[model samples]
Target: MSDIATFARVKRPVVSTWRRRHPDFPAAVSANSGRPLFDGAQVTDWLIATGLGNAAPQELRSELALFGIIALRNRFTPWQLVETLGSLLCLRRLDGRPLADDGANASPTSPPDAEADEALWSALLRRAERIDAEDDFVLRELRAIDATAAPLARLAEDLVESAYDERGAYEWLLAARSRLGLDSLAADAVTPELRSLLTQLTDLGVRLERGESLTLADPHVRVGDLLAALLDDAEDRDRVTVLAADPDDRLTRITRRRFLLAGVSELDLDVQTGSDLEERFADPYLAGPDGPAPSSD
Candidate 1:
């Protein structure tokens, strides 16, 4: 009931009214610990049939994908889901490839079945392990998800297609987190007003740089919003380099992915996970005895 209410953006009583008034409404499919559970697919279909399909198909798909993710939270922590989803989105943006290659190319005409699902999970885990090996934080989160008996890889598969664009995926994931009572996941999310201010600051920086090369750095790079704005307004973007760091590894990775999606080349970017204060003072790019003096702005 709560899930339906959240998805429909309505009150619980409104859902109850629909159940009481609609003759063709779908019934509960099963029960969990005395609580009835309805089939999301059936509910969605009924919603579309009853002139309640205000959400775009893409939005609906993303919402359903989030439902699948939240259902796995009992088996895996919400952070694990966030990390896995972020990695999948990053992989997609970097290349036109799925997180897992199920050898579907080996036999293009083969029908999809249980065997394919198994192969897909295996491939995805293998790739996730590779990523974990490089980043300690990601590795720890992936291990937690792997320890679970639940089929978590399926959640990534369901979400990958709907989250092809980085910015939209980032915002949708934030919304999903809020809906799932996981507001902490987006504690550092940039607000619209902050985004606007960042854009204006970037524009000012670009205007000041003029023809000279500019090196912009954001010590607390949340979602790369500042860097994205800077690049967007830069007239000589090729000469601009971004140095960004955040304490949160997941957010750092997300910032990197967003920058890549924004068409910032790898050579022009330096993103890392660390304390903003330490990064600002100790890093040569930001501030060092032999390096350029850091800007107060």
Candidate 2:
């Protein structure tokens, strides 16, 4: 954590230029203890000012949702808001533009235009998946909000946005269905063609986990989605414990926690609530070796 002085030394110019135009920038970024509170508006402003882009995925999702709410109020299409946010985030990530230039990049010899959109979309999807994979503050906020009802639906869409690739799209659908009570219409949202697309994406994840080549064309459902959906069915509910073989290993990796839930009965529907699973993930103590393991997830 760099002191305010240090941040000013490096980030001062960017902030200064931002303040010159905006004029109402906070005196200094608010912090508790020492870590700065990176709110959505500040983050978006920083990205726009520095041209650095939305590096923080969860935070970006929150910010984009805020943008969507404004759009909804203005009578703009919700889908259009999502597309715009996604495109902007993708472009920023690919360009790695600095905040100083007001986000204008004129270099023509950059990554080919054909490749830029794909790279951008891939970046946004990866960010969204990572947010889903890790239950962060934004995730909790999204879960607390109603997806199919009221003001939160737009936020839910933003959280579940960035389904650029088939796998990402599939995972998001299942996530929405499980968390947002969109289950009845989930299958409808996921067409056969989309399933095929997701199948391929799932295959990629499996291959990566196995440290194998990722050339397969078969569509594979995401392991996370399958697990999440399985846990939601009442019959599939089972008592299982999560054990991390290495106590000191990093918990950030998607593969490290390898959850092993124990309720796979042949004829029973193992059901569990999405919130229950989420609660288990949110527990920091559960990351410790000696903590009592939750039998669900």
Candidate 3:
């Protein structure tokens, strides 16, 4: 890992020190709820504008506030949820292929097409890998209960940021192809049933890349499968949220309205118009009454 990557992954130990050294950092990122107009409505509006939706805003705020507890629970792990932001910040250094000079005694001129492909693919793959890696916490938590769909759904929404660029679209296609290859390779090494399962996953990815829904096979769905389908499409995640949310009239109308207006769906909506949304998008395995609960020792 690079120095910055290492720092981000291991920054918890220095939290207190960093806070003392740079107290302004938190205030910069933190929303002061006590301030006027920075209350629930404003916050929810902001999240909605940013594509996060209100979906349990209060719950999210509370959960965020309990960062210390979450850190302790996970042994102070640094969550790198989508490294795209980081990669974008460091794009000049990380987004392109290195030029080799004097190959066979002379540097070969790079094709513009190939150059474009390399630049785009490098950025996308790095971003996706970072996302999957940083989401290790969500994966581990879900695996404990054999439930991975919720986290996959949430990740799909975040993958929306990649949809605006043409390069991002092609790069996402490349990711799907690579993941398909990995699944195929794994299938070749496993038993017949496992092979069949892996093949199904491969097919799901292919279908998703083609802009089709694979929710019919969601029980057998994996995060890799969802990522393949949703990365290049802005509306993919919103559709998932709509379907995953209750199929109620109200939700359906709101989801449809959002889709028609903004081309995306917001999952965490308020009960009425002024309610505080909870953190309902997680794998639910960690919060459900019948699911694993945080231990109180």
Candidate 4:
């Protein structure tokens, strides 16, 4: 209900009033414990019928995607959700080969089949293992939940085709975490204005390089926002080397997945998860060949 309210930009009371007064309002299709879960498609249809579909298509899709994520959260822990979502994005970045043999069989279009579901889960587990074995636990949890893949796959596909690039998708996920009241460590996420400022600073740094190759490092990489900003503005991407470190393993995985989805070549990237302070001081990449540390300012 809160998700719907947020999407419609109305107070929660307004959503309650609609549910109480409207005879044709969509009913909850399922429940988690005692809380009812409404189908996003049904709710969207109701919005369209009530002349309340004024939200932009992109916003609507994002809202629905967030709703689906919340549904998953009801069954999984916060870390599990993050790990699974990151793995899915990574699989997508790998050309969707892990979802199905042809990369087309595992979609919302296909009706749910027991055999197909098993096959999809098997493929996903294998792919997740290849990316990071630690994520296998989350994949197993995901497989145990029936009806997980269809909605997730649909949401992933929408996100891949959406106008927002990988960085935008990461921001959207952080926003969803806050809006959904999910337990998260998203306070460290970079704001849009700050991201823009960082990108501009990277441009200045590139100019200061005087046409030489640019090497960038972020010791406290929260979702790789600064690194991404630098990469986005670099004209000679092949000449750019990015070194980033973060303490959060899940965040580091998400950042790596986002970077891959952004088409950043692995040769130019070195990301690790550990004590940011330790990595900052010990990482050789942070120092230039001239034996001087670069100014972070």
Candidate 5:
């Protein structure tokens, strides 16, 4: 924390204040004798993107473009490294390809640092474009961070390796929603006890249905956290289908990724964005043009 204060040219308490007040602050990665140690890269990304520190605009400027430092010097950006890396995990899951060829094939957790930053970024983005040709999940985010791709890509790799799978990685990333300033998505991010209660209620509902399938729907699904938490560790994932929608396009895409990576088949998931609804293109179950017959989530 003191180190962060020193780098940001702020008093020690200011850093603490940022941590306490800002839900999107990068969390401490570990602790040394009780002093929390944060990931320097994540901190740097946060400061640069948020324009929080005393660092100048030029110092934080990305190679592609300036991140709105001059006019909105202290402006907070909605873009978070966690969000970008979350998309990358979705891309990797979609492709089933390692984001890097440098020992990633041999080891899922330990990505090599042999390649240059530019080369590694290019290679990973090529893979991203190949998988997400429609720019649905990752292409935009990956391309936007050319300057910080080196650290962020390594971070993404570390996330996948440590979490064991794409679904786990995504859940872990979303767990940092407060730090990433996406607290709005966590409207139902309740206490563990409450989450357990919700799961129990859902289980009871399923039981009342006599082993029938469930069609859970959220009209404004934000990254699918509420639904995902309810369905976590449930044995009926295969039998459960989800119909989710959100006014935010990015959130809808991320929600779709969250469920898809959590073993929800494409046919079992239907997520519509704001535009989809504006055009009346969303069918509830996607069974036909009329959705489910007198049924919906």
Candidate 6:
């Protein structure tokens, strides 16, 4: 009942009222130390059907229910879940198929099954190889969670379904980093104030259009927070070339996928996994009066 109240974004007393007044409310599925535990899915369904709670949107409900299950399972750490879900969402965007039909797509809408855990993992691994042939983004993360990949896949699918796209899903997960106990793992966290400043400084709306694109560089691309902020204002994301580098390999891979989901073509992205102190790319852009592109487009 408390879970239901949380799901509905209502008071605990309201949940009791619901149980007393609404005979159709889902019954307790089991007892957990004398407290009745109702099915999360059932409660979500009831809330959606009866139009009783703030969890009105189907996507929000999916997200909530998935989180509940993740908490119950307590198998993967917050970082593991975030990274693994990112790979699953990336696979879904690239493959255009349900993950479970093959292995670990979230399938929030389907009945739980355990048919193709091994096969699905293998297939997803192969797909990850093909998609990230260089082992840049999704490959290592997928392999890390390979032993129990199926459950993670299902959660990933729910994420995508909730956000209605891979980019939104991945970003949503990242936004919940602090909530997911990932503050320790996360780097250069983008607070609202800093994000606002970054976005204001990165006002590329006109430049992105005038030059047909821009090559935005972030030396500290931990999870691509700053770059993603710039990309958000870009009118032509595909044309924009991103040049970034980070010392952290894992964070770099995450930034790579974040860029991919932002609509920057893989061919156009020039992100690396080390500092660019030596200037690798040819004739690097210099900021000065004598520098090229006086318009700064």
Model number with the top lDDT = 6
Off by over 4 Å in 3: 1-13, 20-247, 254-297
Clash totals in order: 0, 18, 4, 0, 5, 4
* Model 5's TM-score against the true structure: 0.60
Root mean square deviation (Cα) for candidate 5: 11.6
Sliding window of 10 residues with minimal summed lDDT for model 6? 286-295
Cα-based lDDT at residue 75, candidate 3: 26
Instruction: Return the top candidate by TM-score.
Output: 6
In Å, residue 228's CA in model 4 sits off its true spot by 3.1
lDDT of 2 by residue, 1-297 (tens): 232112233354554465567555544546788755434445455554554432444444443444434435343343333333233232223234321123113221123343443343344434434544443112322233221212222233343343332223224333333233334334534345544654453443433344432111101212223333322222222332222222111211111111222222212211222212222222221222233452322
Candidate 2 ranges beyond 4 A from true positions: 1-73, 98-210, 216-297
lDDT preference between candidates 1 and 2, better one: 1
How close is every model to the real structure, measured as TM-score?
Answer: 0.68, 0.24, 0.19, 0.67, 0.60, 0.82
**What lDDT, from 0 to 1, does candidate 3 have?**
0.28
Indicate the residue-level lDDT of 173 in model 1. Answer: 67
lDDT of 4: 0.59
Count residue pairs with overlapping backbones in model 2.
18
For candidate 3, list the clashing residue pairs, or say none: 55-268, 56-277, 56-278, 57-277
lDDT scores in order: 0.60, 0.32, 0.28, 0.59, 0.63, 0.70
Compose the digit string of candidate 4's lDDT tens values, residues 121-240. Answer: 566666655654554223444444444454454555555444365445545665566554554555755677976876665564556357665566666776766566556665556565
Please give, for residues 1-297, the per-residue lDDT of candidate 1 as tens digits. Answer: 877887777777888888898888889989989977887768877776676635655666667778867766675666666666666555545545654454323221123455665566456556656654565223444444432322444445455456655546654665566555557646745567866776675464555475655566777776665456556565456666667777887778767766655655667767878864333323332331233465544
Q: What is the alpha-carbon lDDT for the whole of candidate 6? A: 0.70
The alpha-carbon deviation from the true structure for residue 196 of candidate 5, after best TM-score superposition, in angstroms, is 2.3
Q: Write the per-residue lDDT of candidate 3 for residues 100-177, one digit (tens) a residue.
A: 110111111122244443444444444434443643212222222211112221222222222433233223322332
